[model samples]
Target: MALSLMLRNCPKLKGLSALSRGTFPVSRHQNFTQLVCKNRTALPLAVKCHNQFVKAIEPTRKMSADHSKLWSIEKLFSLILLGVVPATFICPNKILDNLFAVAVVMHFHWGLEACVVDYVRPIIVGPVLPKLALGLLYVVSATTLAALIYYNQHQIGIGQTFRKFWCISGTPADNEAKNQ
Candidate 1:
């Protein structure tokens, strides 16, 4: 009765009862059930087509080698960063700056390594490319850290450089004259 009153008050609600039953008077040329597939076909796919099927992974290989030790090392690096960042800003010690350079570089290398492993995977990029990429990464990281060490030893070091950037209050010419 309430529905009837609504239909009487609003003529647009006349077909609302039909909509509730999903009885829209519409038809398609092709049945959707035949068009859309629900499950994978059991036909002899690429793997099944071959004679020698892939073997199952060994049960003993559940965890990687030195997994716990590696995790602890990563955590140690993180702790060092937690201290080094603030100390670099506040005190700007040469030893701490060296530590900061090494620790920060190592942390960044590991993160970038994970990204390379995920994206430039052996399966997708082929075995040769992945190995080559990883080798290149190691070379670049080594040379970069070496250069950083050289800079820390010879120049004003990373912390002092950052401090100088903050200390400069006047124009570039004035700052240069002051340093000179």
Candidate 2:
């Protein structure tokens, strides 16, 4: 009844001579059933085609091994240093900035580690340390790095801060500030 009212109110449809011929009646339930049947018939074939395409492409895909073997303790330490050093020395804000910088570095490191464990490490040790341990380690490392950065920033003085923080040190602005 509502649909008929809507169709009646539609000025563009009212102007059409074909629509004025008569109210064309059809069963809504029958139309819906026809649409569902059409989609149902097509669905399985569509899924089969997609599965075939995926399978065909899967064999040709290559794993990226750029930092494949760089997962030792020394390398992890270096990564930590790379993240922490810049934040501690370079950032204008002390505690929070340093912590953020360290967190950013650790985040990338952890992500790379996770990818390596999931893809590369499976080929080596058959999923070492369980999934739970891996997740726990990531969370712990991130938290620890954040806390360490905050601690270091609070403990250190500005003069002892590394100049490596700014790409361009000893600029006119710095020199002017120093001169003052």
Best-fitting candidate, measured by lDDT? 1
lDDT of 1 by residue, 1-180 (tens): 565444444543333333333222224764534433332332223233232222211112344566688768988999999999889878887798889889998998888887887789664678999888889889988988998888888998888888988887988899889979
List the lowest-lDDT window of 10 residues for candidate 1.
51-60
Those runs of model 2 whose alpha carbons end farther than 4 Å from true positions after fitting are: 1-91, 118-124, 128-140, 157-160, 164-180
Q: How large is the C-alpha RMSD of every model relative to the true structure?
A: 18.3, 19.4
lDDT of 2 by residue, 9-31 (tens): 46543333332222233355567
Best by TM-score: 1
User: lDDT per model, in order?
Assistant: 0.70, 0.55
The true-versus-predicted C-alpha distance at residue 62 of model 1, in Å, is 7.4
Q: What TM-score should be assigned to candidate 1?
A: 0.60
Instruction: Report clashes for each candidate as comma-separated counts.
Output: 0, 1
TM-score of each: 0.60, 0.31
Candidate 2 TM-score, C-alpha based: 0.31
